[model samples]
Target chain A: MGRTWTLIRRRLLQAIPVILIVSIGIFGLLELAGGDAVDAYLAVTGGGDPAFAERLRQQWGLDAGLWVRFLAYVESLVTLDFGWSVVMSKPVSVAILERLPNTALMMGAAIAFSACLGTLLGGIAALRKGTAADAGITVGALVLNAMPSFWIGLIAIVVFAVKLAWFPLGGIASFDRPDLAIGRVLDVAWHLVLPVTVLGLAYMALYVRLMRSAMIETAASDWVRAARARGLPRLRIVRRHMARPALLPVVTMLGLQAGNLLGGSVVVETVFAIPGLGSLAYDAVSQRDLPLIAGILLVGTLMVIVVNLLVDITYARLDPRVTDDRVRAGGA
Target chain B: MLKVRDLAIRFAGRSASEAGTLAVDGIDLDLDRAQVLALIGESGSGKSATMLALAGLLPKSAKTTGSVLLDDRSILHLDEREKSTVRGRRIGMIFQDPGGSLNPVLTVGDQIDEVVRTHRRLDRRAARAETVSLLSRVGIGDPAARARAYPHQLSGGLKQRVAIAAALAAQPTVILADEPTTALDATVQAQILDLLVNLVQVEHVALLLVTHDLAVAAAVADRIAVMYAGKIVERRGPEQLVTDPGHPYSRALGQAALPFVAAGDGRHAALPELPGRMAEAGGTACAFAPRCPLAIDRCRAQVPPVVPFGDGEAACFRAGETAQ
Candidate 1:
């Protein structure tokens, strides 16, 4: 456990510069793009005088040089200030905090759905390799991989939500719910079903392939061969000896795909009309809401870095040799 | 005792005639308690296949035709589950590389404990006790502490000891060591081989040792069988085979075997080397005839018949004839 913390602490420290560079990169790119709070405001309302735009730029410190503005932004970050969102007319932190949970909840559900069902399918495919079931699952994941999240979400909404009327069309909850808090939770889940499915399909497809190949390769490994020679029951061999080690690759892929999954949610969230960070990020981009965009990027980067840290911890747990290797490399 | 009669193994190809390699052709052997029979051969010679065949460990593509009587029960045709019951309980198997043979994530103790609990049906506490004791029996120090260590944490010799411990957990009557010391260094190799030899004697387990190294086999085996192209060319006591092999292939193997040179033979002399590699199995005539120096037209026209030479047999038409 102490080893895990040490690893996490080192990774987090390493992430500090990466996070700063990403934030500054975004800030610099926005500066180079010749956009500020005033241009975005004028782009929306139109007919703003040059003097008014200048006043607003100066007020927001957008008129400062890139480094000077970035320094101010970093200093504010120390006090947990992400600047004010000219588009949302609120503090950037407040705007992001309000929607962070929604995106987290959606992504958490999607990952949960993918990890469970994907592993199950991949395991079946691997165990019964070269069979019809393996071909069917492999083909199915391929089909899912080819489709876009928006297309999947549209199809799902058309089928399950609109045609069958089993779920609400979109949003976080049924506004006219006359039941208790538990009913609201159920309504939220019902609303979530389509969006989560859409967001999860691509990653689920990825995991299916990863886990299948991993399990196939892992089953062929020397230890698995040893397990079989020991007369371990076939299921026990698959579960403990094969699948457990096979999970390492899948876990690594989870961390690597965290950012991609969040990026995917932008389309899925907009399609389903969920009030999550992704949809917010979409609006933030169109309005050139630099503070809000920068805020989301920082948070997104941190989430990905943290997820990777968790993956490292999981990797160590699943394969103890990883810990020993790290120690051998002088606590690297 | 484990009696194997007319054991043969053939692997099917993608199609009917793509490969059809007879990996282990018809062979017969007897293994009694406390005896070591080493099947020595080169790579692709089917010596390893013979051991894997007895354990029913060959994949589905390989066709095995044999009668394996394990403690008087015919087990050649048994299903996987049924064979598993006989595998760990009646015939234990140790692979060449101990580190590879043990699961990396699991502690060596748990690995041994799993086998003990599986066959013995012992509860956790009792199984753990047996595991530690077995570890100690295999010459591991601080058995309790060592039990908690994973395969990666232990040295090569220690890992081999753990592999031996796992093999001996069920008190199997027959133990198959498939080049059990090949992956270790010279010093560790000898230590593991000695441990296996000692265990076979003390535990009274029938050992079917497989190796490509005739010297290693000669050092430990009571009887040695030299296989060429999926067929055992000669079977005899290790000493006799090393000194005066009946089959030409056995004689070549004896000369080729390293580190166990005959007492009177000049080690520095130009040793006559065997020509060519092992042939792919499946042919009408003698498999070794192409490489055998004593091959005549008849040796090529027909498969050599097993001829009795002293107390053992050699599958050579020219058996008992001295080769120039």
Candidate 2:
């Protein structure tokens, strides 16, 4: 546990500079871009007057030089005060925070769905290696892995929503029952089903392949052979001896896949009308919402860094060899 | 007591064009309590294959035909469930690579205690106590403290001792050690071998030590069986087998062994080498005929049988003819 804390402290210290650099990079790129949010605001107000544009630029502090604006952006981030959204007229953090829970719920369900089902199927395939069952799973997982997530999402909406009428085609919930608490929850869950399945299936195939290969390799290892020779029950050998080590690579992939899943959610959210970070970022980019986009990028970068740190710590926990390496390196 | 009769094994090939390869062909062995039989052979000579057959640890592709009798009951015909019940309870197995044999994530105590709990009706606390005692029995100093360490934390020799401790936890009637010290240092190998010999004497357990080194086999084995191309070509008491090898291959192996020198004379000794590769199994009537120095016309056409000697048997036509 002490080692875990030390690792986390070191990782956090390392990540601080990376996060700052990412923030600076995003801020500078957005600042130097061709489009201006003040120009868009003036266009929305149906006026191209020079006085209104100047007033808007000064109000948002866009008149400042690059270094000054970049410092202000870092300062606001440190204070947890994301600047106002020119498009939404609310704090950038508030706009983002409102949509975060929806995206979290969707991605969480997707990851959980994929991980559990993939591991189970992958284990079965490993146990039945070189059999018809193994071939079936291998081919099926490969086929699913090759399909794009948005295409699957669109097809799922058509089949389950348009044809079967079992689920809604779009939006977070049914607007007709907005005030019904239980109904709204059910409606939200129903809307999430297709999107979750699409995202989960895309990742599920990769997980299945990773887990299956890991299991096969681990099962063929001498330790597993020794476990079998110990006369341990077959299930015990599979679970206690083989599963933990096999799942190590899967856990590592999960951390890497988190960032990718966020990117994937944008496509799925656009098709399904879910107002999550993906859709928010898409809108912010199109409408030139610099503060909002910066806020989203900064938060997303931090999340990925933290998740990666957690994965490393989990690796140390799962394989003591990793911990030993750290100890040999003077508790790095 | 354990007896294996005409034990033959063939591993099924991947494709139809390739026939199943015989790995252990028609071998017989017998052992009583409080004796160690070392099955000595080079790589792919069926020594380890024979041991795996006795333990029923071969894969599904391996077709093992013959009988393994443990105290009069036929263990070969048992189902997987019954076989597993008999495995750790009646026969314990020690592997060559001790570091890889133990689970990396588990503590040494947990691993050994699992074997105890599997064979005996004991609570967690009782199992831990038994594991610690077993570790001490294997001569690990500070057994309690060492029990908490993982496989990675211990040295290779210490890991082998932990493996030995786990094997001993079941109180098996027979212990099958497959090159148990092959991965350890020379000094550590000697210590582990001594520990095994002492355990066999103290507990009255039959031990089957499979090794490729003739020296290792001669050191602790009361009886040694030399295997060539999936068959046991000779079986004799260790002293006689080392000094007066019966089969031509056994004589060749003897000449090939590093000669023991009393003092500085060891500096310039040249070891003799066997000249040819081992014949493929089941392809020749006598697998060793192609490599044997005394291969007569009949040696290539006929399979040799184990003929009786003073107290053992040697599977060679020229074995009795040579009076040396």
Per-prediction DockQ comes to 0.68, 0.69
Give interface RMSD, every candidate, in order. 1.2, 1.1
> What TM-score would chain A of each candidate receive against the reference chain A?
0.94, 0.89
Q: Write the per-residue lDDT of candidate 1 for residues A193-253, one digit (tens) a residue.
A: 8888878877798899989999999889877776766787888888888888888888888
Off by over 4 Å in 2: A42-55, A173-190, A327-332, B16-18, B261-267, B282-286, B320-324
Indicate the DockQ of the complex predicted as candidate 2: 0.69
Error of 2 at A149 (Å): 2.1
The 10 consecutive residues of candidate 1 chain B with the worst lDDT sum are: B258-267
The iRMS of model 2 comes to 1.1
- Model 1 clash tally, residue pairs: 0
The best candidate by DockQ is 2
- Please provide, for model 2 over A129-178, each residue's C-alpha lDDT reduced to its tens digit, 9 standing for 90 to 100: 99999899888877877888778888898899999999989888776876
